[model samples]
Target chain A: MSGWVKIAGLGPGNEALVTPEVTAALAEATDVVGYIPYVARVAERPGLTLHASDNRVEIDRSQHALRMAAEGKRVVVVSSGDPGVFAMAAAVFEALENGPDTWREIPVEVLPGITAMLAAAARAGAPLGHDFCAINLSDNLKPWAVIEKRLRLVAQADFAMAFYNPRSKSRPEGFVKTLEILRQECEPERLILFARAVSRPDEAIRIATLAEATPDMADMQTVVIVGSSLTRVIDRPIGPIVYTPRSTPE
Target chain B: MSGWVKIAGLGPGNEALVTPEVTAALAEATDVVGYIPYVARVAERPGLTLHASDNRVEIDRSQHALRMAAEGKRVVVVSSGDPGVFAMAAAVFEALENGPDTWREIPVEVLPGITAMLAAAARAGAPLGHDFCAINLSDNLKPWAVIEKRLRLVAQADFAMAFYNPRSKSRPEGFVKTLEILRQECEPERLILFARAVSRPDEAIRIATLAEATPDMADMQTVVIVGSSLTRVIDRPIGPIVYTPRSTPE
Candidate 1:
């Protein structure tokens, strides 16, 4: 059997959001590998062997999947959102780049999924309807200074912003400092959305101004979207619909 | 029957990338409305009417969809990719904001899909694995100055950029100016990916450095991705894989 590895996105905690391509890949795989929760999302089938590892072991998981594919086992690496965005696809490519030459010969494909930011943005009208930037606020992989610099620059550019991994138990101060920087660079009326567990049963979406936003509102599950200066909120009997207008006047 | 509007993304030229949620919305839709090519993608069925409009008639199409929905028709407003990003969701919301007060009472939902940038990035590699910004390079809705300012600021901030509507027959000069601004702010050897007709049968993906790139390489069908300074490429017998590393040195 010619074995291959497919890196697939499961979407943001919603089965309906998972593409048929990803579901087909899962059905064909002999081995599934990813973080514990992501792997748990895949069902247990007779022919499939599940390998669920802890967080921060992305490289190790990638190597394992690649090795399995080399040994003629069809491997599927699962990610919570799109694999190309801050997920397993990069780690798999990194593994292939540094690992044995034989690994490169193993065919790998990235099946795109509906990412968390998009899911969150959809749930909250279209706060990211115009030009936007997505930044990973967790300072674990990159320096905190880099995040701060990008935040200030994006604010200056008047781009709506999406933040991933906003606040964690260990690094709660990152989001605190993020709010502080936004307050310094943007107006007090700037709209910010806190969407937690988006697309899941317990999904909570809160739209608040910069003055009303606090750090504790965001957790690891939350994706925080900050609107540009021109983003507007239309009050309705149903709910307030927040969207950035398509046109920008000269 | 009560009326509703569902804004859906069809994914970048591939049926497999469309989510079950979007597929369900289409199945339940009494009318499908969108730009010509996008509306043509929907299969004709009994009781299902597809409203194909010209490229620049987003507001007209949106108002039509809303009116139909208000008349107790289930309407699906389709965009080629995720509707919230440089697409029809904002336009629909804009229409609703300015239209009759009764329009606010209609149920509306945004179903996310595999956006063009994510699909393009997946095709190339994970060039957008790190922080990235999505910009609509066409100056149709916004002034050239705003696009220019954003190009400069994103380059300075070192965010990988995904350019939607990079060039059109009428606005050929916008992409030309974009290249010039990129040259001014970025290094000569920075990698850029031009993914045209992504995931389609005739899909073409090309990777070139900023120095090697030209204005003619892009068109309306293409999504251009410019790598950050830290992005890397791994060459193989098959093709080159481009990705941005997850870490930055202090």
Candidate 2:
């Protein structure tokens, strides 16, 4: 059996989005590792052994999988979105890079999948037209200091930004401060797009503004998109959407 | 017979990357509207009507499709990437907005397709890890003044940027001037990525510097990504993919 680890993109929790190429790779693996919800997307296959855990403990789980792969297991790691976009592909690589050199020989293949940002953009029409950035608010593995630096960077660029891991109860001040910092660099009337439970039926997406979005309007599943300078509010009956471009090059 | 437009994304021109959902959407539509090459991706669909044109006349084809839809014809508008991301969706809406208001109620649906930026990033292995921006070199719709203003914003933001439509026979000077503007706010060593034909059969994605990427290295099909303060170049077998994020935060 191939001992290398394969990182598969499950694609926004919908099995329909999983490509045959990716499914064939997963079917050949002996073990799969992922967050509990993501692992469940595959249902069950006879040859696969699933290792699941809470979302907060991703690093530990990823490290465990890497160890197993190092020991000659055909491991398939799973992520809801494309593995590299804020997913386990990076975690697995980081753990390998920072640890022993013996695991360097372990081949890692990253399969692409759809991300929540694009899904929300698809639902709303064209919020991601201009230059955009995605930042996570969960300050777990990274320091708040670094996150603040990135947020400021995002605002200064005036990029349409989608914020993931925005709030979890313990991180109550997540939105208030980030929005304040963003408002300093961007306009107050700028649109802020929120998408919760995207693609899983009962999916809701809304476009509001910094002055309009309240803390009561957000939760863990929500993705907050702060519009760039050109973001506009349309009068379509299905509510409003924010539109930005890749860039406004001179 | 119902005439609806289903805008599909043909990822970087590779048939394998086009999702099944998009394929099904194409199957349901009678007429397909897009640039000549993009329509060729799904040409073999049985009982399908194909309306293809040169790149210069894409907007005209989109308008024609909307007209067909307005006449109760089920049409599908095809864009190589996501329809909303600088593709055909806006042109269709622009036509609807400029014409009769009755067309607004035509039950228009924008599906999420894989963007070239993400497709390029995936092929490059995590280049867009942190804050990034995308800009188009084409200035047909946007004025040069706006492009310069946005370029300054990109520099001050220190954003990792991907440049779309960087060069054409008409606008060879645009990329050069943009580089000069970017150098004003960033270091000379910043990695500038050029991804041409990503995920396509003849795909080519290269990482260079703003100074290094000349007009010789780019054309209409190129997608250039410029590095941020955090982006680091990793040497791999293919080439260097500039990565920004070190690890996923808690």
Candidate 3:
């Protein structure tokens, strides 16, 4: 039997957000591999084996999936959002690059999913409707200097920004510092959104201005979106709808 | 009966890529409004009315949908990709903000989907795996100077960029100028992916570099992705896989 490896995104914690393509891939998989929570999201079928690993073991997980595929096992590696965005697809490709030459022959494909930022953006009107940039705020992979530099430049460009892995138990100061930089660069009335566990039952959305935004508003599960200079807000019965206008006047 | 407006993304031209949430909204929609091609994607059902409008009529289309929803019709305003990302969601909100106070009482929601850039990135490996920016290249709504300024700053920020509406028959010069600007700022070997009609049967992805890229390589159907300095490519039997690694050296 021919074997292949498919890197798929499960989207942001909602079964309804999972694409039909991903569903079809899961049904055809002989083995599923991913972080514990992501792998848990997949059901246990009679013929399917689940390999759930801890976080920060992306390379190891990638190699395991690659090895399984090399041994003629149909494997699916899952990531919470789009696998191509800060997820397993890059790690899988990195594995393929460093692994044995035979691994190159394996049929690998990446199925896209509704990413966290987009999901969060949808839940909170359309703050990201105009030009935007997405930055990973966790300083684990990159230095704090790099993060600070990108934040400053993104603000200078006046792009609405989405921040992933903004604050964690170990990295609380980063978001605080992020707020400081935005305060320095952006206007006090600049809109910021804190969307936590988006599309999940615990989903909570908070819209605030730069002056009112605090670091404590976001955790690891939250995706923070800061609007561009042109973002507007409309008050209604349900809540305020924030969106960046499509046209920028000369 | 309280009426509501749903600005939903249909994903990038694939039935499987459309979310179940979007599918459900379409089924429930008493009136569907969107660009001609996008509206054609919906089936002709007995009770559903499809209001197909031409391009450059976003405000008009949005107002029409809002009007219908306010009059007790379930209206779904569809965009090709995620409605929040350079699509229709912002337009709908802009209309709401300018319309009468009664229109503000309507329940408006933005349903996210797999955006074209993410879909294109998934098809060609994780080229957008790291920090990235999305810019709409159409000068129809924004000034060309703003677009040029953004291109320069974004390149200096060392971000992978996804350019939507890269080219069209009427405005070919913008993409040509964009290519020239990119060539000036980016490295000669910087990777560029022109993904046309992504996720559709006629989908075509061409991998190029700053030196080899041409304006004629893209059309309105294309989404152009320019990788950051760190983006890498891996050759395989199927094709080359391009991705940007997660970590950066201190």
Candidate 4:
């Protein structure tokens, strides 16, 4: 085993797309720790020690994995997208910081992997053409007031934004406020892209105008791309495509 | 052959991670046209007709592919990253849009794949944690006057920036003006990330200050990430890690 344990992002979805290096790590890890579905990504690995838990247990789960690593065990902390993009890497560090003195010496190596924002941008025909931001409307960690203020400020800046956690069953009303602010400062026809289950089997990607997109089309499983003023959406007979050019000079 | 043909993005590097559906498309196509490097992404198949070309022949290459598709050939147009992100898909559309009347009947599909911005962000510890923009400094088609205005607006907007094609051998003196402008507007302590040939074997990823990341450290092959004012460079004894968090309400 490598001296330091490696926490790798397997990208957004589908295990088959996982790199050979990540696959090899999964095959050899003494334990693979992640949320239930994320841990299931490596379920087929022969003779694996799986530590699957609920989605809300970031701190506790990370602490458990760090303890194993501190004891010199070969553990692989798994994250869906890139390790640090709202993934488990930060939680690992947070846990390590709060761990016992003996565990502070543990070495950690983070291997980069593709993230969903780039994946979503890529999937939707370059909706990430210019400046963009990603915000989690989860409200689990931060209040809606903070997210709203940043959205209003960023929307005014003409950014091509990607919205993560735009809507959930409980958060159905959140995107309405977010979109209202975006429409207030942005043009009505600016493209808004929805990339659902990117790189997964039931993939669905579509580009629509901001006025046409609805929350019914998106769930927590979807990542929305609200194009900057430069972003454009074209509807073909086959499907709709979005493009945000680098910039259009005035 | 089917009436429609698929244009695909083969990703920045590594073939094992290619989506199964995309792989099948390449195998099934009777004809495929792409830049040399992109054409080589898929393994050679005897039944497949491979059309490869020189670097600077974008319009001619795309025109040739469309002409064949008009003649009822199942042609797949390929590019390294997503076909539309400063790549071939849009060029193909541009060519098709202006072509002969008979050519309009052919069907086209743009499939999604990974891009370098994503591959770089994934590797660099998700410095793309918030809003960002990507600009290609190559002035082959667009004018520098336009690039400068867009850069200034985005810089003043407080968006994270990813500079693509910052410099090449021909344009050795590029990115200096961009670096200078952004530095003047943002804090000097803001993080500047250099990720070169990301995901490829000889990858060099370094996190530097805005003042430190001069053009000497970059080339056409690099992806530059200019951090937001909120970005923090955590310098562990191992190395520096860039983290830009959602600004908690003051």
Ranking by DockQ: 3, 1, 2, 4
Candidate 1 lDDT tens digits, A73-140? 99999999899888999999989999999888888888899999999999888889999999999899
**What RMSD value applies to candidate 4?**
3.7
Give the Cα-based TM-score of candidate 3 against the true structure: 0.99
Q: In terms of DockQ, which candidate is strongest? A: 3
Taking the candidates in order, what DockQ does each have? 0.87, 0.37, 0.88, 0.25
Where does the lowest 10-residue lDDT sum fall in candidate 3 chain B?
B1-10
User: Judged by DockQ relative to the true structure, which candidate is superior, 3 or 4?
Assistant: 3
After superposing candidate 2 on the true structure, give the runs of residues whose Cα lies further than 4 Å from its correct spot: A141-158, A182-188, A236-250, B209-213, B233-242, B247-250
CAPRI class assigned to model 2: acceptable
lDDT tens readout by residue for model 1, B109-190:
9998789999999988899999999999878889999999999999999999999999999998999999999999999999
Question: Which of candidates 2 and 4 is the stronger one according to TM-score?
Answer: 2
Query: With candidate 1 superimposed using the best TM-score fit, by how many Å does residue A35's alpha carbon deviate from the native?
Result: 0.6
- In the range A86-177, model 2's lDDT, one tens digit per residue, is 77766665665556766666676776777777777777766776556777777766678767877776676566777877887888897777
Query: Which window of 10 residues has the lowest lDDT sum in candidate 4 chain B?
Result: B241-250
lDDT of 4: 0.70
> Which is better, 2 or 4, measured by lDDT?
2
